[model samples]
Target chain A: MPYISTKTNIVITKEKETTIKEKLGKAIELIPGKSEHWLMLSFEDNASMYFQGKSDSGIAFVEVKLFGSASSSAYDKLTAAITDILKEELELAPDKVYVKYEEVSNWGYNGNNF
Target chain B: MPYISTKTNIVITKEKETTIKEKLGKAIELIPGKSEHWLMLSFEDNASMYFQGKSDSGIAFVEVKLFGSASSSAYDKLTAAITDILKEELELAPDKVYVKYEEVSNWGYNGNNF
Candidate 1:
């Protein structure tokens, strides 16, 4: 694996989970990894990207979570394409948005495994 | 869980995952959730944040991955603190960096669980 993993989180107005899922699913599909590596995508709502305890101005930050697949060098092209899709689909400004990644191992889930 | 989830991805110049980890570890501590929740943290080497097939100008995006315990609300304050830490610790401009979170479920790591 290239071991090139990164993630960012943003807070968007509430909409269909499918909308977010579809957009992210497209990006995840583009990530550089075998189909079985751990690729995570998580979510948070009514949130804000705080800089010094406040919302990030002008731009938006997003966070995604996942549980499977890992990458050394996947998702670079996917993020770039995602920027475009967010702009075209959500009508958000490309310059005002970005992404990040966080991977985990041997962890728990919602009061379980940790 | 509050069902509030989001994520973004970016690329950065090659550096120690520990540096990124320290900045993020602080943020993870700040998330408003019960301890031992599923909060993922994965790393990648030599990456770049893309916006429509190019680098994001003057700003940074981050993606965070996970394996266990889902969160509906937590980690908000943590990302903000991380933003400050990145600026102070790394001397990075606050306006140029942000974070995203992705949570995963029923997943595997490396060539295992999918």
Candidate 2:
């Protein structure tokens, strides 16, 4: 399964947890995996700041860890999808929501691959 | 050499770029590498939102990709240092700045292994 984590640092209400979780859940479900994987996520508020003369609308420091099957294309698509989702859901500019994807192999699964 | 990248989504003044780059420059220099590696980073404004009930001071979606020497202790320290620096430099609350760290192996370097 794809162990996914949708971490964000933004101002959110307690009521918004469900919405955020739901969106992340859907995003994780899109990846190829067949098991109950751990999904860790948290949010931060007002962590992002703007810089002048930049191409990105919203830029973020993203680090994701997943293990199951791996594909660069899927990785790329997921990056775009997750970034897009965050942008739309959070109403963030493009350069604001940066997504960095990581894929661990079966061996990299912390001895879980016996 | 550790190919490191420190991506941020915070408002950075041109004056701040020099300071930001200085901090990041120290960080990258700490890691071991021979040739110059790619340090790609950008900033965003407000991609983080609070969830009310979270332990993390600053929750961030941090994704880092580095390839050079391998050491989890250094990684851990690097994480803590970078996070701490961001917190102190920006004078942001503990939960505002998030740092994601990634390390790629020689093999993961797209056949960079000679």
Candidate 3:
């Protein structure tokens, strides 16, 4: 499973949210063994987030959690794709986006650990 | 910084959200060198989450990311405390909650990396 959780200072509309999910689904698919079916995503807009002590700046924090390991190069690709998606869809600067990854040992699904 | 992002299938009210933030702030302070000032929390309810093949169950996904490493026992303490908070605030079963921890090396804040 791959879950992409994004928190941003920008405000999101219903249309933007739909487009974001679609774009994120495509971005996740760039990694082998990841697909939209197992992808879970949540976007938080107008979040109380501060970057360099300023909360009004346009910033995005993205956490990507996957079931297993990925190469740094693979992560780099995913990061670029996500950054592009946000920049294109939300008018956010690529430099303002932060992407974090986690290779999880055990992920719970269906009341059981996977 | 400590960011606790909670995604659950339960519907949340405004009052419950306030109580959750307060309780989570306390939970963060339970760990040494952590406090409410660096705590950033988000609660996502009625989310699209699936466990073990079913999406209708009462399940919660909690992702906790901290700037540095912590003892497994420390993580255990956090998992228990957060579970308890969700249980009391949202009447969710402890077993239904899944807590994930990540020790991040590079965290960005206020337009700078920490």
Candidate 4:
């Protein structure tokens, strides 16, 4: 299972959120052993986030968690894809985006650990 | 900085949410290199979550990310504290809760990478 969550200071419309979900669904394909079918994406707009001690600026915090391991190269691609997608869709700067990855040893679903 | 984000299917009231956040802020102190001062917590109640091919059940997805490394023992303590707090505050079971941790080398804030 793979879950991608993004929290941004910029507000997003419903249509844009859908577009972003779709784009992230496709972008995640770059990483092996991940698919949109089992993908979960969460977007939070107008978050209480600060940059350089200020909150007026737009920033994005992206968290990516997967069941298995991925190469740094894969993370690089994923970050680029997500940054590009957010920039194009929400005008968020790549420099202002932070993407963190976690390779979880255990994940639970359907009442059982996976 | 340390960020804790939780997604659960159960509905949480504002008072309980505040309690949970405050509890988590204290619980995170168990881990070295983390403090409540720079802690960020987000809670999403009534989330669309599925377990064992079902969505009606109560389940929690907790994601924790920090700037530096933390020991597995530290994680174990964090898990127990979080589970206990969540169970007490939201009445969520420990078995249905999933906690994932990430040690990020790169984090950005205030228009600069940290």
Q: lDDT winner among the candidates?
A: 4
lDDT of 4 by residue, B28-105 (tens): 998997889989989888764543334455778888888877776787788788888877887787766777777788
lDDT of each: 0.44, 0.49, 0.79, 0.80
Residue pairs with backbone atoms closer than 3 Å in model 3 (clashes)? A51-B110, A51-B111, A52-B109, A52-B110, A52-B111, A53-B110, A109-B51, A109-B52, A110-B51, A110-B52
Candidate scoring better on TM-score of 3 and 4: 3
Better of 2 and 3 by DockQ: 3
Ranking by lDDT: 4, 3, 2, 1
Scanning candidate 1 chain B in windows of ten residues, the lowest lDDT window is: B1-10
Please state the i-RMS of candidate 4: 5.7
Candidate with best DockQ: 3
Candidate 2's docking class is: incorrect
DockQ value for model 2:
0.09
Model 1 agreement with the true structure over A30-98: per-residue lDDT tens digits: 654422233344444333332222233433344333344445345345446556655655554554444
DockQ of candidate 1 compared with the true complex: 0.04
lDDT score, residue B15, model 1?
53
Q: Is candidate 1 or candidate 4 better by TM-score?
A: 4
**Which regions of candidate 3 are displaced past 4 Å?**
B1-5, B13-60, B64-114
Off by over 4 Å in 4: B1-5, B13-43, B46-60, B63-114
* TM-score per model over all chains: 0.34, 0.47, 0.61, 0.60
For the candidates in turn, chain A alone yields TM-scores of: 0.51, 0.64, 0.95, 0.96
Q: Is candidate 2 or candidate 4 better by DockQ?
A: 4
